[model samples]
Target chain A: MQFGPHLLLAILEGLVTASILSLTAMGLSLVFGVMRVVNVAHGEAYMLGAVLAWWVTGLIAGHPAAGFVIAAIAAPLIMGALAVASDRLVLKRLNYDPDRTIVATIGLLYIAQQTTLMSFGPDARPVEPPFNQRIALPWLERTEEGWAWFYPWGLSITSYKLFVIAAAALILVAIWLIITRTRAGLLMRATQQDSETAQAFGIPVGTVYSVVFGIGAALAALGAVLVVPIQQAHYLMGGEPLLLSFIVVIIGGLGSLPGTVIAALLIGLSDGIISVFFSPTLAKIIATLLVAMVLVFRPRGLLGKAPA
Target chain B: MLEATGLRAAYGPVEVLHDVSLTARAGEITCLLGRNGAGKSSTLKAILGLLPPSRGTVTLDGAALHALPAHEIPKRGIGYVPQGRRLFRELTVAETIEVGLMTRGEGRETRDWVLDLFPRLRERLGQQAGTLSGGEQQMLATARALCLRPKVLLLDEPTEGLQPSMIDLIRDVTVRMRDEGYAILLVEQRMDAILDLADRAVFLETGRSVETVARADLTPQTLHRRLGV
Candidate 1:
């Protein structure tokens, strides 16, 4: 069987896609798990991150890579502040009622989307890829047999895709370590498990929620910056990923880190394979159906326990 | 070492505690006895600053506690084991204790001390707190509160659903803390245990202090009449 270069490229794209999805979904999961508020505006926050990255990159005199670094660092700080302000001004007053919170976040999301559309315009903006040169994997190359063979025999991959995979893996590990190994992590886990108990233990539950929201916002911003090279910056770019991230979170289980990563990868692979055999619209429909089925059978998600 | 004077609190317009006055001296166990909703939990919460008093004062060693937040209260040498043994259910017993110590910024020394006090906890340190039996959870809650090395420990309903043996273990621990010069304010339903362990007792009825008696002065008939038992 001959595995063409195009198919290999698709697989590589799937990995990168999964990486971006994981980053965005992790934040959504944390906020939902700990706060029990379905922040419909999370997507808008991601869009805001991309906008900040675009604006910051324009200001800094550096390569596209440096631009990404600047955007990644700055966007989260800005978005986090916004999230905290939103919580205090609006969501906090609602007393964390889930239905009310969802409605309020939806309103905020539309406001955010409109603000970006009005300011940045509808056209897609170009963003320079951080690196200019493409690196080839010499170990996996085309042979007399074809592109499909043992890694030592006949397969090839791009260095850019590998970088994306490596970055995502590093982030996943770092998040795991921070949650399990550090004091802040323990507090976060405690808050997630039971806010009332955590508060009684001399933990400032409000501060923990604010900081978690900040970190969650920052992660989404980081994902936007990372995705700039592949998808370019645009006002509407956040919508697709936002929907995909929700699917990822639901599939991964409402707050499990390991589940989020696995779900992201599955979504990425399925999308890639389906897009190869079918249209993007059909692939999306299939993805939605898959999520609905999974939810119907195991509402808690793949790794999630039933909510207490 | 802990005192509340003229403390008044309300949930909305309905007051739960009114002009509540009490004291827990160092080297003594002061137990509060009341029927359900008699403001036993509310008094503990008011002292810890969990519920801001509409009027009155809470002082720890003569330091004003009203202005400070709940988390800050623990730092000032007051440990609280709230109602329902509010242990972090998902965390292991060791982790639950460790979190209490985190606020103090002290290391393993505090944890080791708590474990020594509750040696059974040492055996179940790695077990999830929620998986522990009611008695074990109560022990874990007390151990977690003590991890802060507070001068005063506040316990609410500490022996609600424990076997008699576990209740005895908890009473022994309270007595030991009192001997070690730590002040304790305990709220409990087990009248016999309270009578045995407490140096003095305060009774509340409908959010008002109805009686304050020496532990030796309490009799079954007196308790029955006063508490409507």
Candidate 2:
């Protein structure tokens, strides 16, 4: 069992990364697809989620699950509200114009980063996972006379990590259902396709834009809350997710939700496996290079159509 | 009365409409005819609040339409089928039509009415609008607008690039809408169609609305000689 346990562990870790990445990247994709704006401040929204998760857990003080559950509810709602405010205060004023909103979001990113740094301090804070029951993984090995199954040393996954994966997947499914099944979802799609015509039909394009922006930020925050336990929450932590999600969006197709999720899976799994075997830096570089190559062949990204 | 008085609008520096005043009364189809760049489209856009007029006012039943935003204009019971029948290409027929009922409480009745109006749409409920033929897209756009249950309807070049058969269908639909008590502002260059359908015709020259003539005073020769088209 030279690398059997290691391989399993890497795969498990990769699944976690993919799940979180999908959530964060889907937000980026949704915002871009609908509003046609690149939100440079997406990472800050994610960071805010993590910090709030930590803060909410601290406030509710009785039990880990109780605190975690409350934090989970509060974080997304708060982030969604903040996102709506941001849209009204900044993006909407800019008229969701592509160039202006990019600059606006970058400014927002700094404001968010600095505000958290000033108030929350520069400390990397941790939140306890709801559960921590470690389940050991079995490995196949050639023992003396015959091949046998045995527990390898350090080859176990925590129940909390599994929970992270499951929670992220569930949230993603909810997002899918919202986009596909709901009347509001249909409105968003119509707005995304043609805002002018959408308006012509009384689908308030402005309101839809604000809600879409809020949902996009809310999704990012949800990912951060789920992952804060595993990855410490820090003011500087948003940069990585922001960068990675942008990469995923670019590779997947700008504004395409399905493309974004698929791209997230590809990037997340590769980032995980590569980080385990080699280096995280190398994984990112490889992901960027792969995206470049994909662009050379399919200019609109994996599933994105050429801009109309 | 969907009325505009002294409407002047522009895109940045270039003015497209100059004092373009016209009225589309209930139970009548008012058509705008001119050559390209004649501010025909601009007139419809100004009425819809898509192009905010720098001068003058638009009123519906003496209520200020110029004060409303583009989306709110539709809620004021004004339905617009823009130039080129700008349907949401990726949206399915059902989704596209449902958009019209966004401001309403329940869409089932309106949806049924839309399906009834355009039976072709009933068959392609799940099909993407982009995949539909041009004529079908025109019908869908009209259906989407009609589903709003608008007091006034705006049609921009509904018969442009359509076959004679499709044109006849659109003309029939326009007449039916007029008969059903919709005040319609139509922008079309098809003189023959306009002559047959319009209750009044306002001809634009360059950027100014030159004159408004009742349908009685309009004919192929008179309309053609005035514009030199």
Cα lDDT of all candidates, in order?
A: 0.83, 0.88
Candidate 1: residue A96 Cα off by (Å): 3.4
Query: In CAPRI terms, where does candidate 2 land?
Result: medium
Residue-level error in angstroms, candidate 1, position A280: 1.9
TM-score for chain B of each model, two decimals: 0.94, 0.96
Q: Candidate 1: where are CA atoms >4 Å away?
A: A1-8, A132-158, B12-14
Computed on C-alpha atoms, the DockQ of candidate 2 is 0.72
Predicted candidate 1 versus true structure: per-residue lDDT over A195-267, tens digit per residue: 7667667788778877787778778877887776667677777778889988999999988888999999999
- Complex DockQ per candidate: 0.62, 0.72
Q: Tell me the lDDT of candidate 2.
A: 0.88
Give lDDT tens digits, candidate 2, residues B1-229.
8889999999889899888888889999998888888899888888888888999999999999897888778788898888888888988888777777675444798889878888999999999999999899999989988888889999998998999999999999999999999999898877777787889988888778888999888876777787785
Q: Estimate each model's TM-score.
A: 0.92, 0.96
lDDT per residue for candidate 2 within A20-94, as digits (tens), equals 999999998999888999999999999999999999998987769899999899998999999999999999999
